[model samples]
Target: MKKTVLPTMLSFYAPDLREQIEALPEGTALIGISASGQAIAVDLDAEAPHVLVCTSSGGGSTTVLRSLTAQFLHQGAHALVLDPKRISHLWAKGLPTATHRGNVAGIHDALVGLGEELARRLDLADSELDAAPRLIVSVDSALAALRQLTRYWETFRSKDDPHTSPAVAALEAALWTGRAARVHVILDGTPAPGVLGAAPHELFGTVILARVTASTWQRLAPFTGPAPKPSRHSSRGHVIQQGESHETQAIWMTDADVVTWLTDPDDPQS
Candidate 1:
């Protein structure tokens, strides 16, 4: 069905998809398949909040997120992502981007630097964050580098009380939603307890889930349920999924295929 019985709340987490989808707040809408790079929300229904989840391993580095973010930016949000190599630079397309590489000294500088750039992008002079999704991409070397500073490393924070885990907690606070640009964290599954794939909250807009299957695709909502509703014409039948695959296999979840909110009862558009 093009539109669900009600407004849909989506969640996607696997190799445990079925378990997560069963326990949303009730009547939550989620969509996912073993295949698909990113999930998206494209509704003009201004009365309520709508989100799309697109999670995967490297989908963070691909155009999937860049384009999705560009759409949000166009919608007047300050889109943000934390890319390690500053690769998000290519996606900037001339939008002003202030970057911070965690210097060898202390990551405190990097965080402060990011906070300043965020202040500029969000248009706050004294660096007070407003309650809107302003896009901000804070590309850093690694969470470990920032947190586990060695004597040879430059990111030692006086805040590092050996007893307290400041770096881990600080990173978590920064990435939560309902704050700035609906933050997205990019990690190559190497940070151990703090990888993006196994995070605490799945409130992110989209995550490049994983590619464990044949030429794997991105998973939209891993923490939430992914309701793989067939296309409108085939909700009762089977519809072939189309698209090309490479570096990041590209696919389309058209308005006809995914569940949506009702703003257009006559036709489907994306």
Candidate 2:
């Protein structure tokens, strides 16, 4: 079988590209360009509410999350980023619509807060009330954070507390219920054997592989058919959905670009 390849560069600053992205539907965000030069996008409100990005180190997983978060913010949504490394997506640090948590404690608190919000939304749903603005929780290095969270709980739990990590539990609940309430998670790394209940394919509606390999595909996404080989071009990836893979170039934007996009009120179209 023949394979598709992506362009060497897909500029986020191109005027036409920017226009197309802005013109996307309320809940849709442009992710990248397809192999045939079409604009590839995902609709969080209806399709693929949560996305999992599986990739090796330096394989552009962070780039995918950054692009999605920026688009979500631009669409008048709120973003919560749990980055234990404290280095991914630094552009979101001081943004008004974004909340960044780098430490294990902060990440735990944020997850708990989301759980509370989810409860409120569930209540509103029961009453048929309006939902809040869309919330995108992007977890950078999610596996590492999960491990650290487990250790943190072990060290800090009281005698009467439950054995499982509250943060993880909350996250699991969100995975099951948040789609209806417009709360979404964008996990930037692959899940471990026991993390997230080990059903990543069902939990994450969409999956993107930046650096594809046979073992990784079978482990993280067995139902997606044979894994597409890694693209020769760096930053290229595939978005697998419903047993089909769409070859695409990962969108790349500099930290300064993100800052300008957030702060420049005069250039709303920019």
Q: Rate the local accuracy (lDDT) of all candidates.
A: 0.33, 0.81
TM-score, every prediction: 0.40, 0.92
Clashes of each: 34, 0
lDDT: worst 10-residue window of model 1: 233-242
Weakest lDDT window of 10 consecutive positions for candidate 2:
123-132
Q: Model 1: per-residue lDDT, tens digit, 96-197?
A: 332333343334445444455544544543344444444444333444354443433333436554533343444444554324433334332223333233
Using lDDT, give the best candidate's number.
2
Model 1: lDDT of residue 79: 37
**Can you write out model 2's per-residue Cα lDDT over 1-270, one digit (the tens) per residue?**
344566686778765777787788777888888877666777776555788898887778888888888988988899999989998778888999999999999999899898988887877753453436888999999989999889999998999999989898888788878886778999987776565665777777678887757888887677767877787666688887666678888777777777787789357544
Model 1 TM-score on a 0 to 1 scale? 0.40
